[model samples]
Target: MPRKGMRSVFMKSSSPSPSNSPSRSSTIPPLSPRHTFSESLMEENIEIAQSLITKWDSNSQLSEFSNINSLFNGDRSEARQYLNSVKDLQTAMHYFISHNSSSENLVRAQFLMQTAMKRLEKEFYRILSTNRESLDPESVSSRGSTISSLSDFEEDLEDELRTAGESISEVERVSMAAMADLKAIADCMISSGYGKECVKIYKIIRKSIVDEGLYHLGVEKLSLNQVQKMDWNVLELRIKNWLNAVKIAVKTLFYGERILCDHVFSASASIRESCFTEITKEGAMTLFGFPELVAKCKKSSEKMFRTLDLYEAIINLWPEIESIFSYESNSALRTQAINSLVKLGDAVRTMLTDFESSIQKDSSKTSVPGGGVHPLTRYVMNYITFLGDYSEILADIMADWPLTFQSPLPESYFPSSDDDGPFSAISVRLAWLVLVLLCKLDGKAELYKDVALSYLFLANNLQYVVNKVQSSNIKFLLGDNWVAKHEEKVKQYAANYERMGWSKVFSSLPENPKAEISPEQAKSYFKNFNAAFEEAYRKQTSWIVPDPKLRDELKISVARKLVPLYREYYENHRVGLSRECGSESLVRYAPENLNNYLSDLLYGNGGGGSISSSSSSSSSPSRSHGRHGR
Candidate 1:
């Protein structure tokens, strides 16, 4: 609306002027000639200038001068009002111009308005400079309003009025000068025991500056061309600067009234909220690129389990996270803080999930006496301990929130199937990680295929798991009874070793032969015994028994079960089974020789365990043959 009237006035003013007009020639009065009219117009200009100054000083005629003040103050609603009195005056001037009405008076009138406006502007600046004491922070509170330190102050200027350059610039220049003038005011306020007022004034000024900066960062409207041309990185960097500015303000020294301190603090909070709102509402969240960060975690762990840099990243962001709320007695802010933490928790969970997904589940489960555990399992186990070690930090973060919470938040999302036994959500999350790692190890154990070696492998890994869990924070999660259960499970695998490996060897020996037994039956018994003993020996000697104690115990058990059965059978059948092969040949092994062979099977002796066949078919089954001690 202002543009429409201004447009007409501007157009009227654009046409070239003449010194005198024909229309005035016929109507000229007796004494009042063209020169008199010229003098009257020049006087009129001076009168208008004096009236404008009067209105400015009086604060009267606000309604009449609404557009003029609004244009300067940047009040869009008032600035947009259609021009009123100025319109009628310009309309009359337009009529004179259309009839070739310019005379010397019109020329001076034109020059007069410019001269008056310039002079008025000069005095406006002087008065502002003169009243600088009122802008002082001490006087600021007593004065009606705060003069903010603002950015983009001239950005909202009306397009039509941009040509009104001298008037517009002068006003803005004065406002900025007021701020500079206020600096001495600020120092004066401080030196004169008004530090509290100084801080309060600083708060109002900083808010306007921050709010304007924020406007451009995300909230301000832009043409489609502007949007397309925007460099997204530049926008994000600006937002970061605002956030940093707020942080600096929070840490800024403020020895002032609590009210002023509260204001500075509140202003800082509002800026954070605004920046975060931009992130959430405008999808500026991509600025943070959380998914990409999580991907880095995945890549790191995938490269090597020891590259757990996510922990450091979390630590680095703690201060940002810490500054989210005041945590002073406001329940709503406390609630807000909790909600923010939940969002942060989601981020942490993403990093952890990346870690989990990257682990090579098919990797081996090796645990020797000193070291052999999988790195992921070690990392997972140690990380769980780390969580426990710092759980209090998390607790402190949520402590205020919990007091106002209606129901507790879920600690994890593992979604357990067992309904009866309730575990802490944190415990479940950790357990899931540990068990997934163990499942990977279990797959590796099956690779051995040998029943005894598979059992040995499983035993070693499970033992390591149980021992580490029991000694650390994990003990609380996995209960004390879990160790005994796992130990018993390991023993079952060992029991399987006895049944599959050694029981068949014992089956070959039988009770003593009766007197009625025929020679053929006795020879059959002796031949069967020789075949079974040699078969079991060759198969088992090369098997690894990493535990030396277990290896010795197995050997002793086999010896105790077999020796007596052979001794009883030897007295009854020795004479009969002997004659077929010479007594020497019949003695594949004497009782004592059998004892020695079982004792040495995979014993600690360092030779690569191959049982060589050394037959003595001609030797008698007697003391001399047995005593050879081979």
Candidate 2:
């Protein structure tokens, strides 16, 4: 808990202190026994007279005295002196109370004293009801006690409250003066046509309230009350209005406005200077509070990107804003846009990374595979798609930019002429790879197959371009190993596909009329093709197009292999059953054929009637050389 502001006063009072009575040696100090009794009696009489001032003040001071031992020492001289002082203090307090009876201080003072305070406060309230003028119009409300008593019975109540009030008022005056100055600055900023600076100041004040948690205090109170007593539909309408106001303010300040950088002389000379100073002011600090303010700023930044309107504004301004520090002249605005885009991208990337990490680590049932893909992964994918769409739009806009418009290949948007621009392309490729992996894991092999094929085609074309540009040497050294790794991965996938009964879909026949190969041999063909493609890439010193005819031939070969396998599979499965007679019953079963014969019949015969007559007749058991064995 925080320290109490009044603790020091209590501490000082509790410490040992010298007696108030005069020493015997001092001149005219000690009183005779009779004189002391008389003094005490007079002091008692004075207190009784002052007690009639109000029961509230008397009771409050009595209560205060009960809590402190130092207030009542039981010394006659001390009692006499204390009473005289009490009388004087009460006179002044009464004067003020009578004068400003309708002020908040009166209300507080009356509340402090349970009975007489109430009566006095009630009478003061009555005056307000009857009067035409506002009470204490010239005086602001005080936050502390209105009355001080110095009587021995009320010493604890003589708390220097008036002095405290004066000091507080002084501080308040200074703050008000500063606010006036800020208001002047804001006005000057506006009159001088520094609209952005005005908006900036307004935002600062708005944030001061929010960052201080004052906004939350109000919202919390309002929300609780509404939840308890108000209709939800009505409450929602009010909330909507509040949110709309916030949106409008944000839009007015940031959207389609150049004020942040526009005001030349006034903005540069005054607004920036004043804003920084105001931000550092003690009042600003007090109003905004520390750590909370910083936390609020961080939260608001996150929300700024989350807000759809704010995001759209950013997108719209992307072409017009330069990077905060970028020095490039032509693409300054574009660079700024890039910076903002990168910030948003980084946030998204962080979220995705966190989500991915969670999915990997979470052991919850919801994260289990058959249960569903982790919701975090699904959310990340959605965000990734959003990022992709945003990038696409950005790229389209940038395509018309001066530097990009003249380029023959828009693919230059990728860092490499053959790939995408550095940042965007890399991000996209990584996201694509992750999606493909996820799909494959989920048994959505078909989707992965399509993605893999697209990537492969792109990589191939890029390889071709690299060769054409005589850029193969660097690519060969830096990329060949990576390319080999991809090829190995693809081979593994193709093997898996064949194992899953998809060989007929992915296989190809040899165009060179080679003998029929086993499934293992068929897979080896793809591996060999991959190796040759890599070799061709490594050997190219200059631009050389791989023969298109070779590509087509390979496709045809793959198709032929798949077709033959498909026919054989169908024939084996669909062949008619044969009937046999037993001693007492008839039985039927399928007959197995030689692999070569089946292959030849399926592929060589091509489902046409080209089989030899003898073989055709041999298929019929009745015409065959079946001996009647007993």
Candidate 3:
């Protein structure tokens, strides 16, 4: 029979045993004195507690007895304390296992165990493989042994089939409760539009449970059947929550005070790639049409561009961006994308300049603007200008110069024939005239004259051949009608110039000189004329013509001759006006008007020399004559 005092504490009540329960005992031990425990007596109490713990099918009942024994064993306090601690830990572990034994918890526990084991193994290996010679082998071995003992304890717990089975059932119940609680919280969060927060809480709960159960157990393969049984809708909801979290993170980064712009830039680059893929896959054409989304993207991208420090990154990414320009199905998108790319380029240039300026100014030197203007910008500007100038020249050649030559030559003109035959001669003359006009306009009239004279010689030879061809009835075919048409255009252009006031300048040239001009006088006049022509040409020519050796040589000679005359003109017009107007007025007006008047004198209507002669002597005689003929 059970002892009177021990009956309530140690004796079990009649109850149905769990399936696969351990053998039960009918007799109970007598109670010891409450006070006064000797070492031997304490040892006996510890043994009794161990024996009871070993017999009990349920860990909770075993743990209760162990705690009571610990209170009674006062003399073997340390040993009993260690035993009780182990038992308590084992009981707590059992409770947790029982409450969390759903498939989800099992799977999560296994994963957690694996992760912890990996970390432990890594740390163990790191310590074992360390280079320190002072490491104590005994200490390492003791730690290893402790780990092995814990592993064995977990094995023993697993081997207790009835206890393990009961714990598993309890774990399932607890897991279900936990899942319901989690679901309720998640639903609340979803209703409140705090889905991201819910996801975070759920993650923390899962991790805490998993870490607590599996990290110290070192069990690698726990059951996950219950987890597998959970509704997929939960997972889907979690994923949606995760997506919301990502959106929240992006917004936080964008609005945060930190220079998180670099992160945003990286995010934007990723978003472009990812979202573009979605657009393609989902056939979401309307998404591209959304202006607000596009504007947001553009603003984000611009901000990103502004923050980028690396020029190489810009260059590397520019090609990918350029490819987007070809995707023009959505005009608005295309425009925004293109403009963003342009802004990026500008930003890159700005960054490059800033970086270079920093380098240069390191020693306290001033930096120049346009010093680091990108080669690409320069190339684009030059190409645009060239195209524009070429187009203007084409228009002028087609429309203006040739028509004036259609009227019959006046009787006063020498070599006057019935018809100026095919108008080719007149065209050549007119072209020369146009060239002369250009030189005058350029303030390089003297240089134009020399060049024109050379071209005229060439034209004269060509004309003599044409005459020969006509007289011989050879019917030589000129390659294209460009020459005739170009000449007519030149003539009309010259006539237009006359109407515009060039005739007055032409009338000012020395006419019908009685004496043969001295070589020195001719040279001096040519020199002055050429100098004026070049200056005017540089100022006025819209389309640049490559300077030939002959033109350059003529220019030098003209410059030498005209230096004195220019000085005289400058002295009389500029210096004299400055003296009259005061230095301040001269300074104010000189930058604009002085150069302009000089340009006019050299190229304008009534300059003393003919610019047409210079063009006539050059390769294209007709253009030369037409330039200055009027």
Candidate 4:
């Protein structure tokens, strides 16, 4: 090898010049010159090199080169001795180079060094291949603390490297042994100036493991055109895989590879950094770049959820990304990760804008039947509630994104105790999204011919919104005050519903129930009361309050206001009317009958179900208790 010739040349150059040479006849004898003493030392160093390195040399007649494992046969002492010999040979070669470059022993030392490196190269590859399971990314990561705990003992590498192979039963111990063995070989090779060969083998083997790990994780490199042109179902599957893969790739696969690379090549910072970067760069870039590519694809409402999921996964894994890929050389991976987050956040914001605009632009003017919940109301509230579940994630995403309102949002819409608190951006954004839906609902309510049903529709839909906010993570972001404010609005809408819906019923009763009137007058008032009550009941029977709590509250409020007065008037007029003909028909409803009708009031029973006492009065038995799912 060129190193042998270099060693000889270097030894020749180490010799003193004639001007600086010691005089042989002065302090030293002429027969024992300085060159002679140096030559003697060089011979002793050569004898040490030959004793240790010759048997392993391939060209030796006594022994042919073979696999190091077979040569050692699980003999750890032999393996360690072999490494020590390589190191000794390296020392002896340095002695020869600096002292006696012209000596023939330099050639033998050079040959032995080459033979030792080749054997170590084989040993490195063997240990890596055979112990792959023990040294896998997950195993290595799980044992990270344990592996680090082995650091204080790394100087005693012979004990660790001796335990290599299945003989050491524990996975962690085997991994430590394999790592130590690799490090020992690497240090020997690097010291002997064979670092390139050591690094090359590591890159080839570990890169394949990384690629295979990613492959099993279902990560793939695709062009923008390929991703964009793919169907959403297919793209969504890929996005899901990427979401799962990114976390493992960063935490386990890349992380473990980083630890292993750093450990094996710990003797050389430059080699470890370059080796790890080259091994993991391609897979990691492809892994992190997937989200950005998905973000660039066609934008749609359904795709936004998956996009948010992608965004959340990346945001959660970012700290590990920075720590693991912290090397300046791995900046591209870090950049790729951050870019994915940016594009995902941008995509989410755009989706929000598009969603809000779609709600504002909704041209559906048809009134919901019987003033029941509008489809738009259901769709928007359900969507908003689900979005509310992602509040924390959206908070991070929208930290810098302020809502752009043409007019400042109504104080009633988003009432916060602290104005412009930390959550203002996402809070106002999500609240305004709900506000847009409410405004759209207000327009739809106008389509109702009966003003009473319009108010009822508003009450039902707004109650749904309030319940959605109160029940989710949105409560944390928007706060209790916001929920209470919207809840009060629900009550106001309900009050209006009762006022407009029951005004005629209220007016039909006499000014005083106790007033004594002739039988003719009493019968006429009773007739009017019956007609008004029936009309109001018929009009309101189909209107719905989907929320059970709001439904019950509205029932109690209406009953509280109207039932007592009607019951008192009914008692006052009943005896007088009874004396006249057909009193039961004139006073068609008892007080209990009115309460029963109110009980069934907001069940959304279609086609204005009968107000008669015979109709079922219980709340809708079939309505799902799961408010959002309903």
lDDT leader: 4
| Clashes by residue pair, model 4 | 11-97
lDDT of each: 0.44, 0.33, 0.31, 0.77
* Backbone clashes under 3 angstroms, per model: 6, 13, 76, 1
> Order of all candidates by lDDT, from best down to worst?
4, 1, 2, 3
What value does the lDDT take at residue 106 in candidate 3?
37
Q: RMSD (Cα, Å) of candidate 1?
A: 19.3
* Model 2 lDDT per residue over 72-102, tens place: 2333244334334334334433543544334
lDDT tens digits, residue span 419-494, model 3: 3445433333323322332232233222232343223223222332223223321222121243344344434432
TM-score to true structure, per model:
0.39, 0.26, 0.19, 0.88
RMSD of 4: 6.2
TM-score-sorted candidate list, best first: 4, 1, 2, 3
| TM-score-best of 1 and 4 | 4
- lDDT winner between 2 and 4, please give it: 4
> Candidate 1 lDDT, tens digit per residue, 258-299?
222232223344432432332222211222232222223223
What are the candidates' C-alpha RMSDs?
19.3, 25.3, 26.6, 6.2
